[model samples]
Target: MKNEIDKKLTDKNIKPTAMRQLVLKVLTEQKTATSLPELELEFEKADKVTLYRTLKTFEENKLIHKIEDGTGSVKYALCQDTCECHPQDLHVHFLCDKCKKTYCLNDIPVPTINLPIDFSLESVNMVVKGVCFNCKK
Candidate 1:
């Protein structure tokens, strides 16, 4: 697992450090998108600054993508290995209202929009809110 983590970081041109590896491990283990506060709780003695930096580094490297699910808190989830963080690579996100957990709906691509002249698409954030299967049960 450690080797796999290291390889992933290195492939993204991010130097594999202790903090980076640990944070990546946590992100990889998550079933839903996670916020900074939620990630801080995972560590016994987390350096807030370091954790923030790690997340920023990951985002910059396209190892993870941020999600704004209208919950006020920005969450992050690991990107697919082939993900380039491009507009076309973006997908719809599912936010479970009952559980308040944001999940990556990877199979569902965001619909294409025909922009007006002179307008260009940069990114799109589409979130579908509903009760997740776990909550429905």
Candidate 2:
């Protein structure tokens, strides 16, 4: 299951260290996107610096997307499909209010719209907050 992770890092020129592998392992095994604190708790052996750097590398390589759902906590999720990091497409992410978990809505592709020549947009992340199925039940 984690083999894909190693391959991804290798493809992106990211060296796979023990800590880096653990970070990817955590992300792939996660039920939903996670924040720094959540990840810290998830991997007790991983320090802040390591986790932060891993997240940065993953984001830079377009393997994950950041989710700032206006809740103050910065979250991250796996980039299952094409994202703006590649072609500047909008992506809508879901934030579960009850669990404070975020999930990427990969099926609903982000719409593209034309912008004025004067206005140039680099990237955008759409976030929607609500209770998840488990929380609602």
Candidate 3:
């Protein structure tokens, strides 16, 4: 597992530090997107600044993507191996109202929009809110 985490960081051109490795492991093991507060609670001994910086580095290197699930708090998820963190590479995200968990629906591609010639697209975030399977059960 450590080897895989190291490789993932290296593949994204990021140096594999201990904190980074731990963060990646936690994110990869989680079924839903994670928030900074959640991670802090998981790592009680870890410094908030260090964790925040690690997350920022991951985002900057395209190792993870941020999702705004309309709940005010931002969440982070590991990016797919093929994802370049570009607008076209982004997919849809789902937020479960019951469980309050956010999931990445990578299989469902985001539809392209026909905008005016003057319109320029920087990024796109599509979040569908509903009850997740686990919540329904």
Q: Pick the candidate with the highest TM-score.
A: 1
User: How many clashes in each structure?
Assistant: 0, 0, 0
Per-residue lDDT tens digits for candidate 3, residues 1-137, read 99999999999999999999999999999999999999999999999999999999999999999999999999999999999977789899999999899999999878897789999988889999999999898
Name the weakest run of 10 consecutive residues (lDDT summed) in model 2.
Answer: 81-90
Question: After superposition, which runs of candidate 1 have C-alpha atoms over 4 Å from their true positions?
Answer: none
lDDT of 1 by residue, 28-72 (tens): 999999999999899759889999999999999999999999999
Clashing pairs for model 2 are: none
Positional deviation of 128 in candidate 1, in angstroms?
0.3
Each model's lDDT: 0.95, 0.78, 0.94
Instruction: Indicate the worst ten consecutive residues by lDDT in candidate 3.
Output: 107-116
For model 2, the local distance difference test gives 0.78
TM-score to true structure, per model: 0.98, 0.86, 0.97
Clashing pairs in 1: none
lDDT-better candidate, 2 vs 3: 3
Q: What is the C-alpha RMSD of each candidate to the true structure, in Å?
A: 0.7, 2.0, 0.8
In model 3, which residue pairs have backbone atoms overlapping below 3 Å? none
Writing each residue's lDDT as its tens digit, candidate 2 over 1-137 gives 56887887787778888888888888888778788888889878767898899899888887777888877989888776444364444467888878877787776656776888899777677778888998988
